[model samples]
Target: MNQAPRQRMTAQARRQQLLTVAWQLVRQEGSAALTLGRVAEEAGVSKPVVYEHFTTRQGLLAALYKDFDSRQNALIDAAMAAAGDRLQDKAAVVASSYVNCVLTQGREIPDVLSSLDSTPELAAVKRQYQLDFIEKFRSWFAPFVAPSDIPLATMWGMLGAADAISNAVVAGDISQQEGMQELSALIITTIARCG
Candidate 1:
């Protein structure tokens, strides 16, 4: 009944491993349980290993958010490229991809997001990501609607709706089909109104 020795991993691989373990921890025990030491313990590495990657809890939280955002961006980019040139097709892709990304990550993201907003520094990081996402959305839909016609407020509103509807889907308040349909309609109508 001897335990096997741990295999060596490159620093980059180790960081990815730690992040994956950290996400699993958050999924099971919630974001409050996601301290660097906890991640180190769960990842079967020294605390310094986790510290080397994310020096602080805020740092770890920000990294988690960035990881999630990166995956979401990749999904949207791939789907958008495959989507038809029509506005409705683009809108549907956006809606389905956004919701599907959230659903794919399951319900843990909202907790991670709330944790990110707990501190001003982390909140700023989160806000910057949100702003970037809105800009990306604007650029994607700009072909259909004049950029100026959409207004910053409308973009923010659409983002809000996306977050709300996606969260509802994750929370089981609505079916995946219902959420995607409603979100797709919202995007199309919002762009139509702005145009």
Candidate 2:
């Protein structure tokens, strides 16, 4: 008996499909289950097909991080735009949006992100994303902050506080609402110190 040939997916479609499979596997079985072979099996594709999209495990992890980063930035941007002109409102909106994203990402994402950082390449990618976020925050908040008040270090600290708060939320150390409130207070206090 002969089997039917598989339908061919466009390059972009195939990449997206693999990424979805990878994320599902991570969510279902933790980050330890995210091998290329497992992803191919879960995705109903050949190992070579997965490899074609991501040359190595590190490449695959990097792609996932980039995808996550893009989605997160979009959410933050939308929230910030919809927020009031006041710095406190803007900060609360942004922090709430970010914490909401983390909460909705399923419990496995934080582990996957941590595991992905084991490699130097992946760690560098993570660091680069953090820097990009800091720059974006600096650009957005500059208008509301005093010129001499918000320096680069302060921007970096703000970003770190956001990440730490999100991590705490993910770790179940605090409720999402609490995390948002705490982060908002930090942001408001930081802004106040700027001028």
Candidate 3:
């Protein structure tokens, strides 16, 4: 579907294209350059058509945020596939994969995260994505604990670290490997001692 004709694209497919274009542009130029006119010109469609697909800039950015989240989720699922019995090991995989995805996507995740908390609209858009990811990560770390022993704040902390690591890496203040190692250590130790 990623390769399908722009004209023949299904609603889902067209949205996917919109997401694809948005990611490329945002990744290349950061979120400031994410404009409907720019996306329309790049996708070879009219501005109104772009608006039809994504009613507002935030709507489009929100959709791209979902796309990035899905990609992160898929990477986690793939990492856990061959993981050893240790839930920490699975988490190490998730950290590495998540870090890699965020680093490679440039500034999309960082931009979204930075914009989200301060801006009500973006915060509302990202709210569910944050929750879903936290639940998934919490479950990944669950086997490290007796189900009754796990603390809720641990989930929140780990997800916050994941976002921080992504932002640091995207800001180029840390290397990708550094981000992965720190995340792996932080999450594993947090689960080990607290869970």
Candidate 4:
């Protein structure tokens, strides 16, 4: 009997496939399972393929982190755009959208954090993205608070609190609604206090 020929995927398609497989490993099996070999085996591709796309484990994590942040930032931008002129309304929408994203993404944030935390290059990348996010928050809150009043440290603190609350909701320690409500309140108050 003659076997059918397999369809070949393009390089970009294969890269995306590998990333998807890696993401699944991180989400379902934990970030510890996302070795190049495991990703290769699970993706049904050779180890060389993963190496070709991502020069190192750190490279793969960097790509994943960039993609994750890009997507999350896009969501936040959309939420803020649709939130109208009121800062409180914008804060509530932003908080809800952010926490809801964390709750719905199913371990993506933790997996990204775990996979990228140890690598200095990727860690720097993460930090830069965070700084950019904080800058955007600073711009939004500047009218309410002076540039000196809303320091980067304070913004980082608020973000840390939001993430902690979001993690609690994701882990079932708190309901999603409660988490959103609490986060919205926190964000609003934090903005108000920044003044």
Candidate 5:
């Protein structure tokens, strides 16, 4: 006879738990290893349960992106708010928070970004958030650098670089200090517009 099912999990809680486990597995290994099979195995749930939670790998990836996007955006928002009406300080705050969110949150963020990086479909999902980041940056970065001076392109480049470095550090290919230097260089280039 089948064993009694484990205590039923509320849908929201179950989804959160699945995401928690999915990201953990990705953090430990890589996003490529974050399949329904692995998540089910890690979460102590069946594959069907994972399927019910996420429906597809894309869905799962999208949710993961959403989860971290919320976090990153909040940090950016708080920095902007705390910087008050001062323009230069706002960018500094935002840059510090964005960099810290990537460098400090470490693997959890890198995993989510990696999983969604290659999925062009997710660009549409990410675009809205990108716009929000830009608008916030624009207001903050506009004073010191002309609206035109802010390295919008380089801003994105910095984000990609930070994500890659985080993954590298987790995999032991790069030192955390190395990651910080590289990321700091990107930030400096974006802010200073170095050629």
Candidate 6:
């Protein structure tokens, strides 16, 4: 039997390929099984190549998270752009986009997120992403709740609810439709109270 020769990829393309394989490894074997050497082997690349892109396991984990965050942000932004100005429409988009993003990523994200909290540095990275997300929520809903700024605590509370409900949806504890309906109502109610 003859093996096909591997095709050369650009540096950026190779990094993307490695990230894709890393996510696959996490999805198939959980985040605990993710490692540079394992990703290299799975991608049919040498360990050096993986190391070059992600200097350490922590670096790789961070990249994986950032990749997920980037996708989530894009999805939300696009949905928001298409959403009507009504509070109900915006809230629905937020709930749907968030739940759909997590569902699309499957169960691997929670594991990756747990791994990200294992170290201080990774925790900071995750925290920053959370803070950024909260800011986004503030900006999106602030217009509806204008004349009164949404309290930071309120924003945090909303984020907490979103995470919990989305996790429940992903875990099959609640159906996606149920999660979205609950989340949308919570958002509208929260903003209404603030207003």
Clashes of each: 0, 1, 0, 0, 0, 0
Measured by C-alpha RMSD in angstroms, how accurate is candidate 6?
2.0
Model 2's TM-score against the true structure: 0.91
Task: Give the local distance difference test score of model 2.
Answer: 0.85
Local accuracy of candidate 2 as per-residue lDDT tens digits, 31-90: 887889999999988999999999888888888888888898899998887888888888
Clashes of 1: 0
- Would you list the C-alpha lDDT of every candidate in the order shown? 0.94, 0.85, 0.79, 0.82, 0.71, 0.95
Please provide, for model 6 over 37-122, each residue's C-alpha lDDT reduced to its tens digit, 9 standing for 90 to 100: 99999999899999999999999999999999999999999999999999999999999999999999999899999999999999
Which lDDT tens digits does candidate 1 get at residues 99-174? 9999999988999999988999999999999999999999999988775557899999999999999999999999
Taking all chains together, each candidate's TM-score versus the true structure is 0.95, 0.91, 0.86, 0.89, 0.70, 0.95
- Candidate 2 error regions (>4 Å): 1-6
- Residue 143: error of model 2 in Å? 1.7
Whichever of 1 and 5 has more TM-score, that candidate is 1
Model 4 weakest 10-residue run by lDDT = 140-149
Whose lDDT is greatest here?
6
Residue-wise C-alpha lDDT for candidate 3, range 26-72, written one tens digit per residue:
77887888888899999887899789988988788777777777888
Off by over 4 Å in 4: 1-7, 146-149
Q: For each candidate in turn, give its C-alpha RMSD to the true structure in angstroms.
A: 2.1, 2.3, 4.1, 2.2, 4.7, 2.0
lDDT of 4 by residue, 123-195 (tens): 8888888888888877776777764568777899878887888889988899988988888888778878777
Candidate 6 wrong stretches, greater than 4 Å: 1-7
Q: Higher-TM-score candidate among 3 and 5? A: 3
Which residue pairs does candidate 3 place in steric collision? none
| Candidates ranked by lDDT | 6, 1, 2, 4, 3, 5
Candidate 5 TM-score to native: 0.70
